[model samples]
Target: MSHFNDFNNPQVAALPGHLKQFIVDQHYEHYTPIDHAVWRYVMRQNYSYLKDVAYYPYIPGLTKAGLTIERIPDLQEMNNALAKIGWGAVTVDGFIPPAAFMEYQAYRVLVIAADIRQLKHIEYTPAPDIIHESAGHAPIIADKDYHEYLSYFGSIGAKAMFSAQDFELYEAIRALSILKEMPDADEEEIKKADELVTYRQENMGEPSEMALLSRLHWWTVEYGLIGTLDQPKIYGAGLLSSIGESSSCMNPEVEKLWYTIDALKYSYDITKPQPQLFVTPTFQNLINVLEEFANTMSFRRGGAYGLTKAVESKNTCTAVYSSGLQVSGTITEFKVDKHDNPYFIKTTGPTILAVDNKLLKGHGKDHHKDGFSSPVGKLKNADLPLEDLSADQLKDLGIIVGVQAKLDFESGVTVNGTVKNILSSTEKIQLITFTNCTVTDKKGHILFDPSWGGYDMAVGEKIVSVFCGAADKEAFEEIVYKSKTETHHADYDWKTRELHKLYQQVRNCRLKQGDYGFLGNVWQKLQHDHHDDWLCALEILEMLEHEHIEPALTAEIRQFLGQKATDEPELKKLISDGFYLIAHPVEQNLVF
Candidate 1:
């Protein structure tokens, strides 16, 4: 692979002042008013929802980095804010090629687009626009560890270009990783895709290798994860750059998995909402993982074999067995076939099921019955000993059982049984219960209903609460009461007078722009509905009412408001309570 100089090392001088100045010189014309509004809307909505779910580091980093629900920041201004923590933003057009993207990261400059999609087009935008790239990713860039990990990622991508074997391995691992996460991904298809990747790597030239590397880049860097001990936070540019994905990753329904290099390299699925996310203990851990992989370039040649082993160990593939059946023909065209079929039975791992022919035609189920059909009579465990065979003979017998084998000895009596049952006669179910939990059967019908007071619930069963009516005082107390005293105030205390000043400033701004109809009549609605906090509403209205307001001006306004909101207690409370009073009508109108 081609080696590139690491731009993040201290030996590389800090960004030139002129380059920084050039980015600052870019005007508000670069971003349309609609873009600013979208930025404001998205930042506001996402921040509110993320307050409880986001990692503590992200919450403060966002605020401290000066991101607010008011405007799309100038690249230069954003850089200035991030420079405090040794990070900054760079402007780029939509998506960059993998090589180019890596080059940008190598420089410690995250490329953020400057445009934004309209509210209606937000979710379905075809590419990364300014709002998605900058707002979604820039704030987190301020974190030191995250920044370093990205730098390493760039280095890996750059080097992978040199070796065809390494590139193919990278692609196969990435494809497997992403496919495992996608909901629509077919297991058989995934197996096929992995097999194809392996085959191509073993046979292809540089062009094919490069193509696979590109695919890997798309899946991992643009759409991968940074798992930490506390949580699996998003680091991939795709997730970091998209508002929907950022919030979606934190939902309770999204399953979380422990972080391991092997799990990421061998079993990740990308096309669907991940059933599980791997969390890393720290950014250093992330760096360590990548670094270990990076140093193992020589060993990476055995990618297919390693993946097969991993798949087998994880039990990700199906198992099949058959007996007393003339199961001829090699396990031809097996999934994960590196080159030609190497004796289908000998091929271990997920593809092991392809060895037996009887199992291929729906062997075990009873076909005549409504459920399943079986062609052979059932085999009992006690019947096996009477056959008394050698160890190798018994081994073959085991394989037959796995394939759902039917035995026909001297007599014409036939017997069939599952290897799973033969190995273990009975299954055990463990039950766990929690206080105040409700229990439901496999069909979802309630088996045990907990009273309003509370009740015990069985393990391995679904529990859902039914609120028959408005909660009573006792119920409210049970839910809300805490053992320790809680402080219901901002972490940093602010003077009441300062908050009032901010409120007045915002209110005045809104009043000045109350006549303009842009932003879906935001100013007009604020005048009518938020008469009480008209001043603060007016401020927001004025800031957004103009068609060509400069980003710098917007940044100033946001900084002032952020400071006042932090310094003034009463004003902060008021702003927090009714920040959207004027924008409510606009929101309602837009929702429909």
Candidate 2:
């Protein structure tokens, strides 16, 4: 029987020159027959399944490292093999703190354990035994980039633990590590343990936090896989350690996305197999990712003041605000249908202020007359009918009908130009210009109807709508003129040109006469005719008259142009001419 030693002392002697040397110096014993058998069994089972599924780099790494399914590896021998690749494994008693772990890796030592659990205990070992620590984690340490990443993780982890604000994130990482080692632990028990950790931290003046940890662990360790577009593979320890996760993570259902540092830092899911895995095109790409992460997360530094404050404030305010809001009223009833839209918190409260559809100004004001009345008032009431009722009466009797104002802002920007001129205008528009748009109030509601026929309006327009509607045209025109006066015309012209190019592509594809293949052929011809200058082709088509084109060909072109004109009217017009040219053989011959 082995006793777990306390490896937390900062004054402990530095880890030995190499992991293997440390193991030998510490008098770490060799594995017993049972230990060797367990190692072989795990190695065989995991490798046999992983040989095909493991990252291509890992396949040779295991073989080149001489890690086989025969027996437990001798630490010295394994270290000798690893030494060629600038890595070695050191045996330890059990789990180590983040600081110690970092220190070991910072010195190029990969930590391992020297004992295996009994067969009966294998399924439920609360802590990592030798087999899990050494065989499961060691071989991959031989890879250079991976080894560096591990060292980086250690450094980051150690720094994170010292901060008061990052305590919750730290706990979440620890909890994940604990959970990974003890997969058999009940979900309720795990939740209870998390709660306990959170409680203890809060009592000690540490705010409980874990969402970021969950995201980091999920993307970097659990179910993480990386490779080039041509050859994607697994490198994450969680996937490397387990056969099933490795295979499942690469499935089509698990979406693969480009690896951006911001994406890794902010968003990731840990519960299910990841919906997306970042695919790095090369080892250099991995380095780039690390560099980006270091730069963005300030990984080289100890802690970020702004991030710390945000996390701390969010943690404290969420609990306080949720409690207060819940007391205002419980949602007694709700209704949502195909076209009716969903209604929230329909309840028998004090009748507040109610208004009819006419009160709302916009296109659909008369079509739908749905609204609500909430008795909550703040410092300012924006032109609402609040004068009739007294303060006391207002609290008891205020009703809001039609679409309620969920979020109100002073102004916004709109990109307005003819479809032909949009691209040129885009380049000319100032970056500061705000778009005036209204969003739908319901969940997943559209803020603005980009598909609306009159979406392209003047710039600097202040749009006011009940739901996805614009303010009056006169008001919009005034704002647009003001914005244009302040903005450079060249920038707007550049934007217009860019929009023109996009519209050209959509119009070309849409204005095709037949199937995709047939349309593609026609597009090829048009491209060839205009020396591949789509803009010139559109201009030529727009110049042709309907009488100059055949009816059948014109119909086909019109159908195609219809789809393209939605956002790119210039393309639509071009395709329309192409249809006419195709329909009228005499005109086509004359043009040719």
Candidate 3:
């Protein structure tokens, strides 16, 4: 296996340092035989039921996505197949931050969770897993329209401005998911974590752009439906991966509504099955709705509204000026003019002045370690906008180099200094640095004092946009990559290990055609020792029933499964479904 920041796939290789930090080794050897059994069970169930209802053809997509109905997919193999379709796969421990997840999609890559769902939570698991990420998401990537919408959504989601409350809610969800996945997690502990999640969700106080976008993502990407509302087909990764919900979500009582901008108004509870789902007629409509919602985000609508979101976020974000200058920092405050346009903005700590997402030389965080404050808006006496004025135009206005310049803005901000240097891009003035500069607003608030060293005034007619993260993320060094919380890995007890051995013996029998007598032996062991376990018995029964040999042993195993189903309510559907698939094969019914 390759080490850190190494992947054979080109798409995976192209990831930046920050994203690479989230990648973890798949450790394929760690998956026990029981784990493979769980994966096999879920895939078989999904394929049998989903072939007719899934938007993408189920069987063919399996091969196309580098998956199998037989076992947990090899991550490297999945990447090789995904690469053919302009996509690649990488494994992360569990749930990653949403922004980073979207950014991965923007790069045409899939973020698969390394862990597989436990057998106990076979039907449905709250946490993300290999089944959900690889099987549920990859197959659908074969559709051109759907994949296009997916990548576009990623691009938009990457730029969405999220708030501090959004991060709180995200952490809460992550914690709860980790707790729920642990085999020995306490009920009381789970309840407390769940309550905290619900509380944070309810108290987020008006969702930010990223919060609202997450709703759209949940409704569409995770739980979305397609085709007519009367008979919408399953396409979402959440629905396709969940054996329980994949069937239940199709019930008429679940309430399928048309997908639209109103999806932003709907929120989701990760702990429960969705009571309602949104249906789109086509993948193109998904993009249309996303575009509509994006127009309302701070990334598209700048000035006061956008900057206010940045301040509320209390995290690193970027603000774009009309002059094409990018200011990346944690904005602490902004002052607006009488017309509600942001005329000045301030950052609390290290900041970067960038253009076109590239860091400007000598204008990095170290140079502005104390923070940055810059005045915006048009000059009071300039003919053209300050940003558009050429060198000749600026000199004509007496704003020449090596001269003491006094510039006044219509918004009543004033700058007095000796012109030291000017930075422009394609005739647009991006920044103006000065020595012994003093900046003050109309109300005599000293925004910048001469004692603070050289002043770099950002030039723009208006603040054009605002978004989450630094414009040049590599330059900003996104150290907030690895999550503080980790998904729990359960240590199987001796009894569980013995059960795994039985499962492995069954798999070897099917793959090698080793022995029919061993099936009888395994069945007897299951009846005397691991009597409560049904999956192992089911696998043994499958081989016996397929060969039409060991009739007496087959009947005995069948009786045990029937009785177990009756005793365990949760296993009823699973047992019955397995029986139906065995009797009615999707294809030649190979020995898996």
Candidate 4:
């Protein structure tokens, strides 16, 4: 039996089996003290800088979202806080498929990646880590209109039809993200993974529904700005979480465009900073753009075009007939009529017939183990569409059970057999089973032979809708998008573990644990053994300067950091930022 821990969150518990498959244990104990330190540094910096520029009051929003500047958030704590707002959170291993991610959002559950970025990449990491997921995404959701926009986008995104190439691209990106985040990852391997991502992205022909929707999401949810283009404030999670980009995005070089359907025309590279951003006047405008785009998706516009998209997906999808019957399978081929309407569709492998997203009794994949095929258009001589016909209407056409019938369709397809069963749901004809049946098309090419056993023909005036995944995913046993690549968890070396201990010591000292003397000892160890470390010493200096206890020790630590900053150009800004935040405390912008 598979076990899933929902962390006692109602929204998480309500998730379907297929979606639950993606949920993993948060294992809050696995977070090292150093990891907490990294979280603290990012949160502190974000609060310091984002207070003026962030869309919402950054510090107060963090509290509302169950976060703090002192530590990495515990998942249960986050869930409890989010529950008040009718939301929940869960941890995933790493990058999940975009479709699955969107579905989680639709369920009002945040999928957080529990890992924190390495200390070396403290400023910004391409990987999706705790800082990016919880700090960047969870806090901003406190805004009602913004959260509503997110949930709305999720609902639309969950139904978007994704192509096979889209899956390939997602996998490539996942692999690349995981590799880049791994501290010991090889440069050559990273290069190869990046190339694969580029290859998949470039090769994906005419973007699928999911691809286009992802573009909109990237612009509005991940890297969007709010207010006027000239004086916009940061709202996007990507900007909120990345201390490096949040400051740089304000530069005039990062082109800002008015958010609209036009944003879909722009693609994004996740590995680098966004070259451009979209600005929305209000959060409701974001939903307007999403609604406008959702109208164009295959799920909303069902026909030959929709079926063609489903077939191209090469994944399990469902096509809904006008009769309200649903056929779920991997659509392999679809034949169009002279007017370009789909007349017949075929699934090559296991198929299930459903109505209103419930599987039909005795018509599951077990019964139709091979495939299913049927004509879609109206009969040549029928007064009404097949589904609209009543019992009397069907008997007039000789389509009743236990009757021999030869049915001809307007598209020149014929079904010749003995009608064994006629299935109807909610007064609409849905399925017709035939024994010893032979089906043929206009050119006399046999569609189905008697040797293939009973033929179950789906009844519909036409295929009215087609969308991604099974109509009833649990019933279909569809596990959509399980990635093979796993995130690399670092096994800390003894020396690294010692460094974490020193950081932990300082954290304890800052909590007023009467361990002020430990600072001098920790500073001595850093100078003698860990010459390159700067953040730990910086924290120590902050404590000393605050208390004014050891002027000589404070001056010495400050001199060390200044020298280190000058020696390492990359560490210069981080050291200075630490200095600046200490001197210039950001006022607590908290909301009640």
TM-scores of the models, in the order given: 0.41, 0.40, 0.97, 0.97
Off by over 4 Å in 2: 1-35, 57-60, 63-66, 113-133, 148-162, 165-191, 194-218, 221-223, 228-231, 265-275, 297-592
**TM-score winner among the candidates?**
3
- In the order shown, what is each candidate's alpha-carbon RMSD? 25.0, 34.7, 1.6, 1.7
Give the alpha carbon lDDT tens digit for every residue of 541-572 in model 2: 43233224444443444444556655565444
- Candidate 1, residues 395-511, lDDT tens digits: the string is 565523334443332222333333222211112111111233333322344433435222211111111111110112121111111112111111223443343444444444444
Task: Write down the lDDT that model 1 would get.
Answer: 0.41
Q: What count of clashes does model 4 give?
A: 0
The TM-score that candidate 4 achieves is 0.97
Runs of candidate 4 exceeding 4 Å displacement: 586-592
For candidate 2, what is the TM-score? 0.40
lDDT of each: 0.41, 0.39, 0.88, 0.88
Which residue pairs of candidate 4 clash?
Answer: none
How far is 490's C-alpha from truth in model 2 (Å)?
78
